[model samples]
Target chain A: MNRRQFLSWLRRLAKTAAAGVVGLAGSRWLRAGFLGAEAAPPAQRPIRPPGALPEARFRAACTRCLLCGEVCSAMCIAFPSRIEGSQPPLRRAPGAMERQELAPPVWRGDDTPYILPWKRACNLCMRCGEVCPTGALRPIAVDRQTIAREVRMGVALIDRKVCLPWTRTSWCGACLTACPYRQRAITVDHQGRPTVHPEHCVGCGLCVEVCPLRYKAIAVDPPFAPDRGAVRAE
Target chain B: MILRGWLSRRRRRWPGGARKVQVLRRTLQLLVLALLFAIPTLSLYDNLRNQRDEVGIQSRWDTRLVHRLVADLEEPKALTQAVRGSVWTFKAGELVISDPLAVVDFVAASRVPWDRFLITALLPVLLSLLLGRVFCGWLCPADLLFELAGKARNWAGIKTDVTFSRGTKTAVLAAGVVAAVILGNQVFAEIYPPRIVGAELYLWITFGTFGAGAWFFLALIAFEIFVSRRFWCRYVCPGGALYALLGRYRLLRLEVDPVACTECRLCNVSCELGLDPMGGRFGQDCNNCGLCVRACGHDALNWRLGLPPSGGVDRLGHPESGVAAATPGEPAP
Candidate 1:
């Protein structure tokens, strides 16, 4: 995204952050001190699975494509604007202006994970790596394979108005054509726009790849739980 | 005031005796340096021997009896010392180096700054060992620069002497020593005056350590492009003069016959160091690049089978003719 959109997103993200902190404080106070009459929101609605190992593996795979950053419903993942070159942890910046390798240092097949700072701290979304053709990131079997947890492209969100599947209006099915899912998560409507099935959405954000809009109709989004907010690192 | 006046007068008279005196002075300097270098070398031999027996490092010169004699002369302190140095290849690290102390000393008090070490090492050796001093004829970053500058200068119709002060290498050596003392190990480490072996240890070490090594390499590349006549290899090079000095005393040296010289001056024009091979001095900086020898249409400049008829070979032993046509110590005539 251009600087203007990035700034706007930052502004919107700041407001979201403030609202989240207030909600977290309210919920914690009610659950502990107030009577148990009030039904509280499920703090841990495990999405996909007990995905600790898989999430770490996904982080390893995600290249921090702004596709995921743009699609994040909760916008939990924060892409760093700057980091020191010396630190190994901050070395991975998504969209860094240099070529990168996938699994570097050991698997030396055209290592593409480097120079692109987006390589590190990906929020279990394989969108950026998927966008990369250089194998800086790889296509992995995220769920079904039961072997190693390879990063699958994270959640793809659809804008109901623009997306053909959700809006029930006439729209093209190009995003449906782009997505790798067999049971089409997105469907076209009578109008020329796209529609999304939230229950079926795996959050791969491949629709963003074909989406003509700068902020894709279908894109990857980071996990949003205010209690387990992302720990900002230098 | 007195020194300036004397230098001005001497500069005006570029006589034969002055040239001979310069050669003699350089030879003396070489002798001193050889002695200095030998002391550490012998100690290194002993270290190598010890390492062979205990540390499993095989010795190349162990069987040679001369090593024992050389080892007797070295001080104990000159054996185990390590200093900041760069080796490019994994082979170098594996080879069980015999001269750690000497290499350390050379790196620490490098006759040239770390940046210019390549020239500093190669230059003095070129002058002392063979007359073919053009590392660029074989290996030099400055040669690349000079090639660029020569094209530029030709376009501009400019011709300036690429060669300059003879003692400039000594000054460079002194500069390197001082620089090393002031700046800890890595001063001007990248693109040093020595033979850059392979990937370079400096690059590997400096990546996570001192940040300057990477920048120094970039700067050196830029200097190589912009500098006129490759001044980096010429005056600024500390090792070149040391090599020139060493070349004077080297077992093998270049000599010429004035009687045979048609004085075509092709050799002069072709010389990368700007040494006029026909200019009577047989230039200490002469790397015997043999451009003049090749350029000679007169068939005059062929390497002699042995010493010249004039017996100048006695003055410099194991003489090498310009064309490598000459034999060693030809009859001592």
Candidate 2:
């Protein structure tokens, strides 16, 4: 072959090699969970909307259409603007425009819908799933049985150290009154201290919103949270 | 041949078809813009109504008009639920439509047809196959924004003549697909302007804030203003690339009338994508927006229904170079 043709062949070979290298690196990254685990620890991970797929699958499935947030009646769902770390829940309201300017984390889909239950929890209305075209959030029926069975967003845990009833400061059954699952998810003892049944709790975070404490004695933790598992196991 | 003749005859018979198409395109563009704002506004009203019952608080914003509009409809449930999602993945009840690029990104990343992705993707795929990159011209909200940005640049006395290879878009598409496959995430949806515009608008309307995607979108607008004209759609839109590829052999193509032709170059100047309509060099890039057809003072450009010609529209001015060459019996009118 002439020198020109030889050079063209060499160029083609180099391009193929470069493409191969990129493909290899991408696969390694995917397998290593570069887009998933390394970005945020389990504890730092934001609470996903109800009926959402597991973190990895949700990231893959969600096109970040923002429909879930649009349909949220409580106006609870929020998309993180920061590239690496999500802002604290209470901080979402103030200076929203400035928050939007923050650089998003590199590896994550920036449009995924997350809820800050302490500020505005999911109403268990199941509208987000109905509107989610991607099935990132499975369309769960609004029935109590179906929501309780299918939805496992997280579980509510009461901090005895801070809770008024548990601390013997006052008779507080705010969480029990606010719990959607009522007797099934939360119950009060003779002394009127509210207890959370982790197995029955759907983690809707109604208790967290109505805790009536400055620090919020009751909070929702992801079902896989290490401390939650330990508490359940214990 | 008979169907082609009838179609061409109908187009000719439809008085002012060229101008009508442009008007229709603008109307559709405006309709899409209206829907983008309206859908989220209605949802906001619905959400706030629900909030009133659940949270025992009055909705701060007044939505009396939205309530009246919804109240006028006999059945608002389907209207509310069916008409959701952004431009990336629009759902009209059982008929879920998605952008072709989003579909490719999802499939490449997940390596699975999760949910109704394949079904949702089918309509846009078919649309591009028939009409070419019509979405970029007719319905993309970002297209409207980019055009306004271009006009603003003109008004501000900013001149940007920068140009890049059209193939850059295809390369970007390939790279995006590869990156998505490796990263196991939808890459194009994260950055595509049309999707970003829709998602950002929804965020702003519903939550009174924009996502980081809004900043990215604004940066793109700024780039278009300062660096290139319609930069994303021309040189680097992976979605536009996918649409171009899918619509490569589209049935409807822009044709120039050789007989009535005055090489005024107005059509070329009118084309947003920098395609050569004066020379009929649109190839697979003409969005069938019909802007060139409307721009022709000589009334030389019109839509033709058939497969793309073997080598682009026959060299602009040659007597035997246009549709007449293909259908021998039909002389130039």
Candidate 3:
């Protein structure tokens, strides 16, 4: 090879080496971002699908393939859209476009599926977990007992002020009847007032869906919420 | 008889079987797109029966013909599940296959089992090593869209030749992987067009509603049509960049025989990625689409197995010329 040929070869080599170094540096930076320090956790805990791992681990493991959402029979599982003032915990590097959105938006809990009970309630079909390619949502049996034990979607909170039976406006046993756990999780006393046993309640939200009152008498709160004395015995 | 004679003469015009290969490629692309759309539709119909049975709803209309046809064509649940992902499948207690770029992100962000990595990332990596980014040419739905855009641009006489450094895609891929790790999610998977197409179609058939991601997909198509020609695949797509890197020194490469040189620049025009087959300067950017090879009327350009010299020898087999020949790394000007 002559002088000019050697220089051209060296230029190509240098370019390739530079790319390799950039790739390595970027990867190292990312690794540091992931393992070195943790970002502040989101303030509000969204209700995750059944069998979901803890928040941090769930985020790490999920590939965001949307298989869980696709397999849901109840169509209860929904991804969060862009919500103002809520940013995803993962921070993009400087120069990355903020408003120029891609697949999952920048909202906290955007890619992960959550059940909104008012729209539709999880019937404990267990199909989401079953179809999850990544084990982010651990696959559990579709049996009622299994779901009641393994799935703690949320806790039921009943407002006595709004409840028809509790307010003495009407006798309503709808919540008690709709509870998948029936006598164990929910029960109606002689006065026809339905009481929720938080310890047994899986918070599948069937009661919320089936409530006949104009305003929902019972609402499902996120699983981690502290129990308040909402349900009263006759 | 005159029409038949004219047709035969037209067929005889292009020699070296170029038209035949072009037809084959076009057919394959269309068939793949059709299959992508069909799988979800059939799966929806098959599951609809079970749904109706559970609800105890009976239809008086005898739709046996449509039902039977769909049922016959319906893919197994496991197979349908596999198709849910663009590059990975976890099925029957095994990680079936995965794209290497996804695997890189998965490994970086999460603690996946070693066996899972071996099962999923190994085959695609191996195939890419041998073939060199053939999937971008043969499988990617974006390629079809970009080709149509290119055709439209040509028809409309829009001569927009925007070029970025070939390294831009590699940089983008690296940045994307880093972002995925930081985000603790495969964000690239969400924006990837082919996967989005499949996911959108699946959602539409299953629930009659699709997500906001569908709008993102439409925006990308529109950008391809109006803003840049093949920009996403050429400069922005992380998956394509990863494949190109993996298959840089691919086994099956375009070889131009020096002796059979009738220096026609048709091959140059035929390359959608702007590679120069006549000059024998194809880099990782060449998707091995065979369009340039098909365009070469001189039977000079063909896919051959063997490593060509990095940069040496002129068209007449003479060594050490005045100006150095263009290396694969150097993009065509």
Clashing pairs in 2: A83-A103, A83-A104, A83-A105, A84-A105
**Best candidate, TM-score:** 2
Q: CA lDDT of A18 in candidate 1? A: 77
| Regions of candidate 2 where Cα sits further than 4 Å from its true position | A1-45, A82-109, A223-234, B1-16, B51-62, B72-82, B113-115, B311-333
Task: List DockQ for all candidates.
Answer: 0.01, 0.27, 0.13
Point out where model 3 deviates above 4 Å.
Answer: A1-46, A78-111, A224-234, B1-18, B53-95, B111-118, B307-331
Stretch of 10 with least lDDT, candidate 3 chain B: B54-63
Root-mean-square deviation of every model: 27.4, 14.2, 13.9
Interface RMSD of 3: 10.9
Which of 2 and 3 is the better model by DockQ? Answer: 2
| Lowest lDDT block of 10, candidate 2 chain A | A34-43
What C-alpha lDDT values do all the predictions have? 0.37, 0.73, 0.64
Which ten-residue region of model 2 chain B has the weakest summed lDDT?
A: B324-333
Clashing residue pairs in all predictions, respectively, total: 73, 4, 0
What is candidate 3's CA lDDT for residue A118?
Answer: 53
**What order do candidates take by lDDT, descending?**
2, 3, 1
What ranking of all candidate models by TM-score puts the best one first? 2, 3, 1
